[model samples]
Target: MAHGEGSHNRNSVEAGLEARGAELTGRLIKVVLDGEALHRLSALQEADRTQAVADLEAENEFSPLSHPELESVLHLSIQEGRMVFDIRDSHETPLMAIVLAMGPFKMLIKDYQMLLDSYAGAIAEGREAKIQAIDMGRRGLHNEGAELMQARLEGKVMIDFPTARRLFTLVCALHQKL
Candidate 1:
């Protein structure tokens, strides 16, 4: 083959490849766009306003207590040996219905934080009457308590009688000097 002819043939092959690549790329882009459009349409259809309002009203009727108020309801449920359900069930008291129906996890977390604050306060006050060295020792102990409390808040620690008993002992012992 002639030198110029060889160069011309190579250029033609390269141009053909580029054209085919562009066409394939365009088709792939169109497929992605179609998928995204369908996803958006599905989301819009799912966001039905009337259904949302009805759901909101239903939830509201079940749980009239605010997030902060959930603790008392939980306590009541525990005392009564009742299993609380967010959905309608025969065993649900009005308090149980209200608490279980709202943002249960959020309210539980908020209540946990409040309880943690009280725990921290009890630790702080408990250490106040001790000598500085003993207080320091108690602070170290309290750091462990804090970590345990964090684990409890994260649902790693299950609330049980044994755990409560240990915690009560620690709190009582901490305050003895004060």
Candidate 2:
């Protein structure tokens, strides 16, 4: 094959891959933690609460692997000792509700809560040095939690690493800090 032809073929392949990726980018329009979950997440300071939600929604990837075309709003709730992912379409039509036992995530959630409290305290006190270190720990925990989530949802839902991290953060927030 001519060198020019080979280059053109590669470009075509790249374009096709990009198109396919777009198809799989199932967006999460909103994520709501049901009221029964928690009254307040004291680990996060009052001021940063709103921003945290914004951060999660800013750039998240969530699509039911089984239904990539179904963009959704998710309602998370704890029911009967399990976490429920109540997914709905744009029109508020139900898509699927996945219930997962929280046992697998118990310890991870506790660790995340501790990190959040430490991180929030560091920020509030203007302890710049501590802030970076705490954030590093937070990231590590988030990565671990995300990996666990991927394994747990392997065939049911498709959430990229970042999305899983954000969702896990929210779950930690749902825990009533003691």
Candidate 3:
């Protein structure tokens, strides 16, 4: 199997992950359909890393797996800050729009609300549950913050002098819900 650049090479990718305190492993696979090339490389968990590989045909096109498959793909393991998939793909290039066209944008917004709901549930549980509950509440706020960040990342929204006020109001509303 051949390896690509940008955090995919076995040694470099693992080294990068180690620097960040996450341990990961690499797998390089070259798929051939009747001897024709269909390249696939996977960096999986050292133990049963095979679990990390998903069949391209089995997942929804809008799901992260297929989303990357259509163009070149990349998967980022958030916990590690290391890309599990290719990092080179991008807009105006071989970049596959995250097949979430149904809309991935809306789904991201919905995810933010889901996180808020999770926090609300925790808050209602009681002060005896304070430690864990507070943690959940913090995560809820984080989710909303992440949503705003993702919106800007996807170019679905942007910030300037005027938008900050609206953003502030949005945060207040979400906090009230929590």
* Candidate that would win on lDDT: 2
Q: What does candidate 2's lDDT look like per residue over 1-178, in tens digits?
A: 2113233433454465467773456778877777544566463633333554676567776768556766788887777768788898888788899989889988888887777778878988999999999989978887887777766765567666667777776766665432
Error of 1 at 111 (Å): 27
Pitting candidate 2 against candidate 3, the one with the higher TM-score is: 2
Candidate 1, run of 10 with poorest lDDT? 25-34
Per-residue lDDT over 72-153 for candidate 3, one digit per residue giving the tens place of the 0 to 100 score: 2333221222112232233423333221121222443355445445545655665456547655654554444444433432
Error of 3 at 156 (Å): 11
TM-score of every prediction relative to native: 0.21, 0.75, 0.23
Candidate 1 residues lying further than 4 Å off, grouped into runs, are 1-130, 156-178
Q: Rank the candidates by lDDT, best first.
A: 2, 3, 1
Q: Considering TM-score, where higher is better, how would the candidates rank from best to worst?
A: 2, 3, 1
Better of 1 and 3 by lDDT: 3
Q: Pick the candidate with the highest TM-score.
A: 2
Which RMSD values do the candidates have, in order? 26.8, 8.1, 19.7
Q: Which of the two candidates, 2 or 3, achieves a greater lDDT against the reference? A: 2
